[model samples]
Target: VAGQFGKSAVAAAPTLLTKELTFNFQQKRSIQLAMVELEDMPVRSEAEELVFSLLIAILPERLPEQTQLLSNYPNPFNPETWIPFELSQDSKVSVTIYNVAGTPVRNISVGYLQAGSYVSQLKSVYWDGKSDTGERVSSGTYFYQIRAGDYTETRKMVILK
Candidate 1:
């Protein structure tokens, strides 16, 4: 509270009147803490500083890491197949199954997933040789792709009748 900006630092922060205590990085090179309370409530100064510093320090490591999608198991699958992959960091990901002709068939995941290796079994939703609409058809080769953050990989499989 007593460095580059001078004692008037507290007065300059009109909008920060709501900052449980404001640290103005733009106005000064050093840090200063003011007792100005946002509401009539109280705050634990040490706890707030600890939390803020920890978050600021970890910012560089928060990005999702790279990953690889492994090939599906039982290449000539009939009723089901297991797809596996690995991620080096936490990420939002999705595994999509596609027919031989390149049509999205099913979503193996519904939301974000954690980092690490994973394997998911996809049931043959319509291997009656048809798609979701309920018509009979033929199949030879199909594919599935796993997308994690900015990384994406597609692997092929054979579906035989």
Candidate 2:
């Protein structure tokens, strides 16, 4: 899938008839892709300068300044949702879900996590609309509180039937 210099060059390489991917070349092909031709070679640069430029170009988003709780997805969810947040530093984390009457329903203890992001669904805390006793919760308003070491914050969400 590699593209040419600023231009898209599309051609199929030799592949087997099966669904599995292949990297080895076979001599049974009739057509072939263009061969790579280089007119100039790479010039050597300072290691620090190359590293700094690469970092600056690739790292556009920095770490969070302060640890805090972020909003959960699909506020009025049916069966499941994810809670996303970022941490300023390493600390133990926990998420507790409470009902409208302030009674705790679920508790998720996320041991020690490093300082970074838990914002993506794959890395964030997940709730399956179940209580700590492993029973599904009813449709209603719910509050979630996050405790990360010395930092604490709370947010609200809703569950739908």
Q: What are the models' TM-scores?
A: 0.48, 0.66
lDDT at position 144, candidate 2:
95
lDDT of 2 by residue, 52-89 (tens): 33333333244466898989998889899999989877
Over 44-91, each residue of candidate 1 has an lDDT whose tens digit, in order, gives 565464444433332212211347777767777765567777666666
**For each candidate, what is the lDDT?**
0.54, 0.72
lDDT for predicted candidate 1 compared with the true structure:
0.54
Query: How good is model 2 by TM-score?
Result: 0.66
Question: What's the CA error at residue 130 for candidate 2, in Å?
Answer: 0.3
The most accurate candidate by lDDT is 2
Q: Which portions of model 2 miss their true places by more than 4 Å?
A: 1-54
Question: Clashing pairs in model 2?
Answer: none
lDDT of 2: 0.72
Backbone clash count, each prediction separately: 0, 0
> Distance from true position, residue 139, model 1, in Å?
3.1
